[model samples]
Target chain A: MIILEYLTVIFLLIGGFFLLVGSIGLFRLPDFYMRLHAPTKASTLGIGSILVASIIFYSFKGDGVSIKEFLITLFMFLTAPITAHMLSKAALHVRQPPRPDTLNIDQLENIRDRK
Target chain B: MLENTVLAVSAAIGVSLLLNLWRFMKGPHMLDRILALDTMYINAIALIVLLGIYMGSPLYYEGALLIAMLGFVSTSAVCKFILRGDIIE
Candidate 1:
């Protein structure tokens, strides 16, 4: 009973913290590829935690287990990486410039040229 | 307890949205703008989910789900278009 409240609060705080970290990382990162690293990892975890909080609250608040949050969680987890991959590939295809001295930039060049 | 936590969390999400918007506006390239837009939609979904929790109803869950699906598809489609001149092979 009381534990559920504690759990929800903890989850909400965790989610909020991660969400802020992700956005701040996105804003502060130096390169487009580096920037891609921020939101996909941090935001997914943030949203996952928040959805977990919602799932826990709703499951106990009602007679049946509210399974909708699971769907969103699963879908987010599955798609975030794919979206990031597509965006990065597109960036590479379009020759979106990266910060000078970016490590292994030649590898990216190889990929771009392979196509 | 949950009520106050929801308030605080929603505030955090709002601040994040503003940051994303700043990135979108000042981005140097189309991909940067797309990235910012991508981050924005995720934050929006989180905001909607937070609202549903605050209201103590799952009424907004459907909207959240739809946004999740649509955001993914739209982002992917845009990426595809930018990758190749045409979306279809």
Candidate 2:
């Protein structure tokens, strides 16, 4: 029981660290598309870690294992990438500026023009 | 000791939420604001779950679940609106 509590603490701390990193990346990253990548990936994993800790804590407390946290984690994993894709597509449709060194700039511009 | 750990985690998540809010407000582009909003809700969900653990109550889970569902729907709707200039069309 003591070990499980320690593990939960570790997981929660790691999740918090990743959440902070994702937010910092969101604020600091240049270009809309680049910023989109940060929170989508990092925060998803962060939340996943936190949820896992919640599941373990509750189960050990005799809550008979709250599956809702698991469901939320699964839902987040399934939807985060798709959300990022749609957001990027929207950014592209609106011609959100990209960093000058961004690759295939011409291709993206061509796609916009073709639209 | 366990309570202290949860408190520290909550504080970290709160700082993350503040940063996300800064981005949402300072965004020079629509997509940046939208992304910040999306990230904010996810962080909020994390906070709520942590609160649930801290309080030793399962009640907060429902609120977290609702936020998760609503946040995703709103984000997708906003993205669709941006992409097509009409969410329903």
Candidate 3:
């Protein structure tokens, strides 16, 4: 009904598009590390945008602006990498097979030495 | 207009969830599944926010926040287990 609500809806749709892009990238990307980057970075952005729209809508509706949504977004951004890093470490520790085209940067022996 | 927009956002999010579910089912590895689950959580959060808008209340936002926090903690713990074979250490 209001201009702000319309704009919020448009922004939410754009966020949905980004989410789809992240999913497609997840399936299409060649390898694990590369795939890791796609969902965490892209989809997180997607969700954050939509949440922002919701915040705008709610605030304009005079329900008072909600802070919880923003907090969720902040936590998502913070934890995505930490989770990804742990996964990558596990992948490397287990010597999980890399994709065909992936090049190993360091030897297991060097990894052990560095530890 | 607001109602139509909310419906559209919900539909888009539902479709997104379906795609992520496909990834979860056809995973090549555990990390892939984890990633898919993470994506699902993000979508769910958005869905909840939109639902909150539809209901015109802050209650749904609180639910969304809890889901986000729990999802993050679970994913991180899983990752830790996958890497170190123990959640604590």
Candidate 4:
């Protein structure tokens, strides 16, 4: 196996592991805020590494360094946080209840009522 | 070696996508469903990337990119409509 192949394999493994974790978090999290943040948190690292692996593998394919992966990576970085924020805002607007057992949400209404 | 790894990784991601689907169907709140859909598309991108690697072709990248763009836009539009009762200002 060539060095590039090894690198690609390693990165693909990492990306897959994180993507699984993210979805698991989304499935298991009790609240909207938690679930919204879960995938974005893991996806940046997960998809980012997957894209990186693509870049490395394709560049070695003699396509003269395919840059499409970089564009996807940039898009993820630029929009992930915005997506998270927007989702959270929608959750708040719709009043998706947060976890009651954990955290001191004593000021939850105060926070939600500001806008 | 790379083929085996890709196969394994793709299986793992497929499982993850299933989990996302479950959440989408069963989520308690509207936002939870949206979040699941968002997560699902992101997972799809990973799957597409793995497919490209396994197939040793760069053709799938365009699909991956298109999905990413469309996913974000749709997600944002839904969230905005829910928040303000309309998408466009």
Candidate 1 ranges with C-alpha deviation above 4 Å: none
Q: Model 4 in CAPRI terms: which quality? A: high
Interface RMSD of 3: 1.6
- The lDDT of each candidate is 0.91, 0.90, 0.79, 0.88
For candidate 1, write residues B1-89 as lDDT tens digits.
Answer: 78988999999999999999999999888888888898888998899999998988899999988999999998999999998777888
Clashes of each: 0, 0, 0, 0
lDDT string for model 4 (A1-115, tens) is: 2999899989989998989999999988777777776798897789999999889888887878787799999999999999999888777777777888758677777777965
lDDT of 3 by residue, A1-115 (tens): 4788778878888887887778777767877778788788888888888888887887787856655578877877887787777777766666666665556554644553435
The most accurate candidate by DockQ is 1
Over the stretch B13-62, how does candidate 3's per-residue lDDT look in tens digits?
Answer: 78878888988998888888988898888888888888887887768877
| Per-residue accuracy of model 2 over B1-89 as CA lDDT, tens digit each | 87998999899989999999999999998889999999999999999999999999989988988998998999999999998889897
The alpha-carbon RMSD values of the candidates against the true structure, listed in the order shown, are: 1.1, 1.2, 2.3, 1.4
Candidate 3 chain B, poorest ten consecutive residues by summed lDDT: B80-89
CAPRI tier for the interface of model 1: high
- Over 4 Å off, model 2: A113-115
Model 1 gets an lDDT of 0.91
Candidate 1 vs candidate 3: the DockQ winner is 1
Cα error of candidate 3 at position B61, Å: 0.8
Instruction: Give the TM-score comparing model 2 with the true structure, all chains together.
Output: 0.96
Question: In DockQ, how does model 4 score against the reference complex?
Answer: 0.90
For residue A6, model 3's alpha carbon misses the true position, in angstroms, by: 2.5
